[model samples]
Target: MDWLTRANRRIHRTLHARPANGWKPDRFRKMALPPIAPPGWWKALLRLPRDHYVRLFTRHSSVHPPAVGRCIEVAAAMGQVLVTCDGVGVARHARSWASHQTITDPEHTAAAAAARKASAATKPASVEVTELEERSLETNDRIFDVIDDGLSTGEGLA
Candidate 1:
């Protein structure tokens, strides 16, 4: 080794602080410290691209799969509860995919509508032109009363 390296080590050893001069050798020799294990790594690390479905994927399919980035909670004993991303009530579709291979949510309805949009123009339109006679409100007084009564009672007029 270089002279400077040797000289530094020698000086460092001389300058190093030592234990108490009256310390017992037997007690010092008997001193022992417990070993420490490494920290857990797998449970702490979420493998790559944190935004993906890896956080929600179960088996080979994803459950609910988020409707417009919203969380969907479905109970195995109950049914599916799907809401929009903004937490707005969109549509209620009963849990019917029991023992199925894929999950179908409200978002899929839009996709199905888009796929069927191409054929929307293929069907012929049905228009019925009718002539109606204008009548005064006095002619339907009984109907209005019935409707008001139904509304007051929280019941359908029909």
Candidate 2:
């Protein structure tokens, strides 16, 4: 501190031929005030589009049913909700640890099972490639080959 202060004083005195007082006008008085807000200040903020999902992540920790419920409540208050938790606790619990383990939600499990059942019942439509479509795909592949060849040869078609 002493060295720095001495060097600073020496530099100031050498440059300006005077000791540095390090004093200035009141910075508070020179500060500018923020501009006034327009009439509908929260219009943009409050405007919500339809069909949006609120994603909440519980990273690396398993949440019990009550905690999950609370999270869901908060998310629901915001909008459409989806709460996700990423944890190895379930696997660990399954392996051995049997004390103070609150890691299962029966209702959520049942809902997931039902969703799986419904999904399995609904079969996806099979897609068939037409002759013209196959030719177009081949043409696209050739275009990529041409692009790769041109780029490798430095012909500037990349």
Candidate 3:
């Protein structure tokens, strides 16, 4: 057998050895077969544009409003809990809640969409788009900001 097939069989054997709770023996037996890869056309479609998938998924989120609503509710609850536990007053609590809301609220969805559009527009037409190194850098920068914010607020960095 080829390496891929051997690896898949090994995985199947390992998974079947320790069946999960509520797992049916028949299902486990069926799962021993190698997973079928998507056809060439499907792979080609996926390879077309990464942003297409991102936009499609984000659009899907709008179609299912419950996800956004859940996010808002969770964020609000977290903010409220934080304020209550910390014993912060009304104004401070409101500010804290607003900050959390800014990150999760559907109202900021427009700004995020605009930012994505701006980024796509800024891409060099001549060059092929590779993995987003800029986003990785931005993520690292945000981590630094979180660290700095914590340090400044006397949250002792270890």
Best by lDDT: 1
Error of 2 at 30 (Å): 33
Model 3 CA lDDT for position 86? 21
lDDT against the true structure, per candidate, is: 0.41, 0.37, 0.34
Candidate 1, residue 13: how far the Cα is off, in Å? 69
Q: In angstroms, give how far residue 78 of model 1 lies from its true place.
A: 1.1
lDDT of 3 by residue, 1-158 (tens): 58655554443554654333325766667745459853322110111122211122122111112122121111123223211112221111221322213213353355557667887889667977688545666586576775554464565855
Clashing pairs counted in every model: 0, 0, 0
Clashes of 2: 0
Off by over 4 Å in 2: 1-102, 133-158
lDDT, candidate 1, 1-158, per-residue tens: 58655554443455363333323654777846658754322121222221212222231122222243444332221343333333453334443444533444545445546546865868778989899999887567655664564464556665
lDDT (C-alpha) at residue 146 in model 3: 50
What tens digits encode model 2's per-residue C-alpha lDDT throughout 23-122?
3434545767669744431111111112111222331212233233222221111222223233122111121133333443455456556666887999
Error at 104, model 3, angstroms = 4.6
lDDT of 3: 0.34
* Residue 63 shift from truth in candidate 1, angstroms: 11
How do the predictions measure up, each by TM-score?
Answer: 0.21, 0.25, 0.18
- Best candidate according to TM-score: 2
